[model samples]
Target: MTWKSLKTVLASLVAVALAACSPTPSSGPEATVTVFAAASLTDALTEIAADYERDEGTRVRLSFGASGAVARQVEAGAPADVVILADPIWMDRLAAAGRLDEQRFDLLANSLVVIAPVDAAASQDVFEALSGGGRLAIGTPESVPAGAYARTWLQATGRWKAVQDRLVFAADVRGVRAFVARHEAALGIVYRSDVVGQDAVRIVLEPPPEEQPAIVYPAAGAADGGAEGRALLDYLRTPRAAAIFRLHGFEPVA
Candidate 1:
C-alpha cells in the first residue's frame, strides 16, 4: 500500500478505538427518590426500597429516625422526596408548614409492648416489673412517637406518675430496645415491630386494647418531590409493600 493509504488506515483504526472508549449514552434519565421515615419502619422500608429499585430502576434513598426528628428535618429543609412518620401529629405539623404535598394518608399501625432482657424472668405484670427498683427505658416523649404512645399507656393504666422517677429516656424506640437488650434498663416499652428479629430482648407484656394508645403511621410526599416523589408514595401503598410491612409486624392500613 502507498504511504497515503497506510495513513488513512491508521486514522480509521484511531477513530474505532476512540469510539470504543467513549461512554455510551443511557437509555433514560437517571432517577433517584429520597424517603425520610420513622425509625420503627426501618427494616420494612429498606426491603421495600430494594424491591422498588429492582422493579422500577429508580434509586430509593432512605433516612430513618424518630418521627418527630424526621419531621423536624423536613421542616429544616432536608432534601426528602417522601416522608413516613409514626404519628399523624408530626405529619400535621409538616402539612401546616407547607412542607408536604396534598397526598397524605395513614400507612400502618402498631401496638405497644413491654420488653425485658431475654434472660430476665418473664413477668406479664407491668407494675410488678417496675416495682423491682430498676430503670425502665422508653423513647423521649418530646420527639418520639413511640415514647408518646408508651406514656399514654402508662397513664391509662395509672402508672405514669408512679414510674416517673425510674424512667430512662432514649432518642428512639430502637435505643430503648438496645438499652434493654444490653441489660442497662430492667424493662422497656416499645413497638411490637421493634422486637422482631431481636433475640436479646423478649416482649413481656402487650398493653390491653383499652390501655393501648392508637398507633398510626402517616406517609406523605414532599412539596418539592414532584413526579418521582409522588410515584414513590404511590408505590409504598401497593400490595408488595404491604406484604413487607406485615412481615415486619406492622399492620398496613387499608
Candidate 2:
C-alpha cells in the first residue's frame, strides 16, 4: 500500500478503537425508592408517587400495610429506603435502635371516627350503640396505634369496660373499616382518612376532644437509605405532597 493511504487506514482504525473505548452516555437519572407506607396512606402516597416519578424519573416502589407491621419489617432488616407510618411509636423505636438517618417528624395527622354499615340504622350515638353489646371492631391495641387510641378514648369516656367484651379486634385501622363495610361488625372505630372514599359505611360519630386521642403519622429515612431515599423523604414533606394528603382527609403536621 502507498504510505499516505496506509497512514489514512491506520488513522481510521485508531478512530474506531477510540470510539469503542468511550463510555456509553447515561440514559437518564433513573432510580427506585423503596418505600414502606402505612395502610391509611395508600391512596395519597400512590398519587404523590406518580407525580414524583414523572418529575424525577424515579420509581417509587411502595409497600402498604399496618404501621406496626411495616415497622417490624424495617426493624427486621427489610430493604426499605423510607418509612411513613400512622403513628410515631414505631418511629421512636427505630430511632432508639439507631436505624434512622435523622430525627423523624410528623408527616400527617388524622382523627378518630365511629362508623356503621350503610344498611344499618342511623346511630349517631356511638356510645349508645356500643353500649348495646353488638360487635364493635377496632385495631388490636397491643401494636396498632389506632386501636390503642380507641382503647384510650373508650377508657377516658368510661365506655371501655362496659363494651370491652363486645370488642372485635383487628390488625389495623383498615381491618376495622373492612369489618364495618362488610357488615361483619355493627360498629367500628377507625381513622377518618380510612373511610373517605368508602361507600359501604357512614360516619356515626366524630369523637369529641375529650374522647379523641392525638394521632400523628411520623416518617423518616432508613439509616441505610442513599441520597435518592433522602430526596424521596424530602419530597413527601413538600407542599405538593401536603396538598395531596389533605385531599385524602389527612392534616399536615407542621
Candidate 3:
C-alpha cells in the first residue's frame, strides 16, 4: 500500500477501537434524583433542592406529602432516591424494611404550639379553649407526628380527657392549620415551624421546654439510590442546607 493508504487505514482502526470502548446510552450520564419529604419541609427542601440542582448540575424531583403516607409509598417500592420525614418511627421502619439505607440521622428539631386565628381571641390555655367553646383541631393521633405529640402533651398535663370530646382530628399538621385558618376549628396544635409566616393565624402557647415531647425530622438515602442520590444526601448535611432549614424555622441537629 502507498504511505497515504497506510496512514488512512491506521486512522480508521483507531476510530473503530475508540467507538468500541465508549459506554452505551444506558450507561451515560445519571438521571435526576427523586426525593420524598414531609409536607412541612416543602418550602425549605424546595429551596435546598434548587440549590443542590444548581450546584451539582443534576436535576431533582421533589415530592412532599404526609410523613406516613410518603413512608408507605417508599415501603411499597416507590422510585424514591431519598426519604426525609417528620416522624422518626417511619424512618426506622423504612430502614428496617430494607427500603432505606442503614445509616440515618436526625435532620432537625421543632417545637409544638397552640395556634388561634388572627381575628379570634382564643385563650392560650388548652383546656379553657376546648371546654369553653368551639372544636379543637389536631392531627389524627395514629398517623401524624404533630398530633401524636400534642396528645402526649395534653395527657402529660392531665388535660386530654377534658378536651377529647371537643377534639377535631385532621389528616396531618398542615391540615390542622387549614382548620384553624378557615375558622372551622377554634384552636389548633402544630409544629413551631408550621406556624411561621402565617398571616392568618397566631401562636397562642407552647409547652414548657422540659415538658414538650421531642420533635425531630429524620433523613436517609433510599436503598435503591444511585451516586446522584448519595451526593444529594451528603449535600443535605452541609452548613448551607442547615442554614436554609434554620431560615425556615427548623433547628438543625446540634
- Say which candidate scores most in TM-score: 1
lDDT of 3 by residue, 1-254 (tens): 99999999999999999999988777566569999988889889999989988888789999987788899999999999889999999888898899987657888999998888889865545456555578889998877888888999989988888888899999888899999999999899988888878898888887889988989999888999877788887888899999998888899996
TM-scores, all candidates, are 0.89, 0.88, 0.86
Candidate 1 error regions (>4 Å): 1-24, 27-29, 124-126
Tens digits of per-residue lDDT, candidate 2, 100-124, equal 8873678888999988998877654
- The candidate maximizing lDDT is 1
Candidate scoring better on TM-score of 2 and 3: 2
True lDDT of residue 1, candidate 2: 95
Clash number for each model: 0, 0, 0
- Which pairs clash in model 1? none
Ranked by lDDT, the better of candidates 1 and 2 is 1
Instruction: Summing lDDT over every window of 10 consecutive residues in candidate 1, give the lowest-scoring window.
Output: 123-132
Output the TM-score of candidate 2: 0.88
Give the candidate order by descending lDDT.
Answer: 1, 3, 2
lDDT of residue 83 for candidate 2? 86
